[model samples]
Target: MFRILLGREGRVWREALAAVLAAEEDLEVVAELAHTDEVPVVAARKRPDVVVLDHALPGSLTVPDLCEKLGAALPGSVVLVLMDQRGGALSTALARLAPRVGVLTTDATPWQLVESVRQLVRGETVLDAKVAVAALTARDNPLTDRERDVLRLAADGAPAKEIATELFLSAGTVRNYLSRVIAKTGARTRIEAIRIAQASGWI
Candidate 1:
């Protein structure tokens, strides 16, 4: 049997996923975690073969950090992301974290979920074709490389001065890049501009 750890913040989804996995003859859900911070601990304890994580977890634990931590703790374990239909940005971000990660739509049938789990257990990465195409087509990056670097740092809630220091540019230069990004994305403020850029896969 393939041991699994399910992670989700919402009670309803957690229960539903547990039930689905329990019905499988070759899968066993050994732990269910409610917070991202709990993942590493529980996974370490249970030594699960795969971890199924919901994208909507709380706290400052970004998906990348979660994947890295889990991989470090359990070298051979696979991390699969459970995302909603609209979670394009989150999918993109998670893709950058680990190559073994895959995204599955929440609306997928229980059979699909079980099959995906089986694929992960066999060291295969499985992303729905539609989600992969949508994510790739959405990669309409309009900003220049430098502008994207500035925008990404800004989106992480960094100040203009700090971003300038990190990017080795003057603060005024960073401001200029931000202005152009704002105009290009048709956003009224820096935060809105970052949001638009991220949504469109420009950052």
Candidate 2:
């Protein structure tokens, strides 16, 4: 049998997913979790062959970090992530983590979910067609880590000096980073760049 563990919130939809997989004679729903942190402890005991992950699950680590932890602990286990948006940090970073990762949107059909799970068990990678195209066509996020940090603080209405004080950098250096952020985002001003980054899910 192909055992599955669901790591997600939205109890109603998750249970509906369980019902769908339960119809398959060779599939079993081993466990369901409301948070990402539960996966390590609960899944360690169950040793499920697959895990259905949600993008919003809470943990001390980020989504990609949790995936790495699960991948290492579960050995041959794989993940089928229910994507929230078409592109974001999680989707962008996925390729670097688990080769067996399956990406799909919440709007995907039940049949698609089932097929993806089966493909995962067969050691194949699955990505929704829309996700594939968006990920392929999306512009590479241009902001570096420090640039993103400086811009994120700026977005929160922090003045350059306050940002520099918080990050332990000189005021002039903060302005330079802000200028690069504006140019990279093709925005007219810092506020505009912040809007672009927030809209693109980069900050």
Which prediction has the highest TM-score against the true structure?
A: 2
Residue pairs whose backbone atoms clash in candidate 2: none
State the displacement of the C-alpha of residue 153, model 1, in Å, after optimal TM-score superposition: 19
Indicate the worst ten consecutive residues by lDDT in candidate 2. 55-64
Candidate 2 residue-wise lDDT, 52-99, digit = tens: 888656444455667788888887999888875645654667755535
Write candidate 1's Cα lDDT for 60-141 as tens digits: 4555578888888898888888876554555565666544677787878899999988887777777876667556666555
Root-mean-square deviation of each candidate, in angstroms? 6.9, 6.2
Note the Cα lDDT for every prediction shown: 0.78, 0.79
For model 2 the TM-score comes to 0.70
lDDT of 1 at 105: 78
Query: Against the true structure, candidate 1 has what lDDT?
Result: 0.78
